[model samples]
Target: MKIRQLQFFFLAIFFVLILSGCGSSSATKEDKVIKIGATAGPYSDQVTEGIKPLLEDKGYDVEVVEYTDYVQPNLSLDQGDIDANVFQNSLYMKDFAETRGLDIIEAIKVPTAPIAIYSEKHDSIDDVEDGQSIATSNDPVNQARALAMLEDLGWIKLKEGVDPTKASEKDIAEYIKKVEIKPLEPAQLPRAMSDVDYSFVNGNFAISSGLKLNGAVYLEKTPPHYMIGVTVRESDEDAQFVKDIIEAYQSESFKKLNEEDEKYEGYVLPEWMN
Candidate 1:
């Protein structure tokens, strides 16, 4: 009787071990995998450097897809090539979707990096001499932002009722300082700072060129609508994967990266995250 009882006990322990192994395999199989698409530079770095590890800790396999062009991230998301994208801000994405007919939607706002005007020759806008040259991006979107920054700086007055998003050089109603507007490629603006009286530099390009945000003579206060977000397909908005991404983004670790890292310097966190 004692020998039979011992054999039964050993058999039960063996069965339990097999069941535990099966459970572990099931959990591994259930791990969610998601891919995010973003442009090169800070946006990509935010994921690859920060969010990627956090999600991995939660058993998510995260893939960050990078694109150099502005158009393809939305196109890829719309076609299900990626689960999400983190490239353009809300306003630009809205304009891109309306024009391209892509059905992408903003899921959650990410940190903002604003357009800034830097002056190497002048301490302030008031110091700019009359008829001096100021350079801005030749691209229309950035040029519009540069114009808006100039208007806010009181250097020029845009036409009354001119939409800031669509404003152009022709929309300048008055030159407060008689400064000439020189449109140049955004990448060249950082280098052009020495050449022009003042240069409008996009945030990412500025950071890459070793320009510090603290050195800007003027920086635009980005509106909530101008903040970047995790853009996703309408169909995937309610998915648990989407929630996981947002949670990972809003984590304390993510905030710490912006606070402690030079790469994320001058990033403005979303109001909701605050």
Candidate 2:
């Protein structure tokens, strides 16, 4: 009887030890790291230099994973490979998530990459020749935006009742008196400027290619443009670490960085998060 009681007590203690070990391991795993995805450009570089330190001070091990393509970052987030990403805007994020059946959500609006129209052949939009070829981004959303800007500037007219978000070359039922529109990939727009009369390029890509703002005939203003933001899975939206990182990004220090960068002149700014 005495031996059996001792055996039972030892077995209970062994089970308790096992459970405690498992709980400790789980806690360690939960506190491992925070990974963020970004593309290779001002966006990624700025976050690495400006935002990473802020997050680090808040007790997060910040890792900025670099990506080249736009599609992979969201896909990685959906698969739980990354904690967050800082590349896309609300409109583009909505379109991507709906198409891919992902549950990603925006954490905060970062800044806007102004869409601009540049020309090597002409000095300004007014100087564009009749029947001149104008190249724009080939991506559906950006293509629509470029077309809308042209319409806004009175360079072209769209059919009545056409939806601006869904605008495309096919929607141009009536020809603008004398302008030939050509759609090209955003990256290729800068190069196309030498080939075509003008090309609409995103500000980031244009700056990366060493194109000067002084040379651009027209550039989009910051206020009305779609602002880019940090994104995470809907599941992690309320995670404490994620919230801390976002708070750091919206700090006054980051705002000062945006104000001082000459390249960003009137092109981008931190969103007023108040």
Please tell me which predicted candidate would have the highest TM-score against the true structure. Answer: 2
Taking all chains together, each candidate's TM-score versus the true structure is 0.79, 0.86
Q: Clashing residue pairs in candidate 2, if any? A: none
Q: Candidate 1 residues 1-274, lDDT tens each? A: 9999999999999999999999978866654778899866778888898889988888888899987566788998888778899877777787788888878789889886777789888898678778899999886777888888888878899999999988999999999879999998767888998888988877766766777787888777887766878999887778788888889888888888888897677777799767
Give the range of the ten consecutive residues with the poorest summed lDDT in model 2: 265-274
Predicted candidate 2 versus true structure: per-residue lDDT over 32-54, tens digit per residue: 57888987666686688778888
Off by over 4 Å in 2: 1-32, 222-225, 270-274
Which pairs clash inside model 1? Answer: none
lDDT of 2: 0.79
Summing lDDT over every window of 10 consecutive residues in candidate 1, give the lowest-scoring window.
26-35
Q: Model 1: how far is 205 from its true place, Å?
A: 2.1
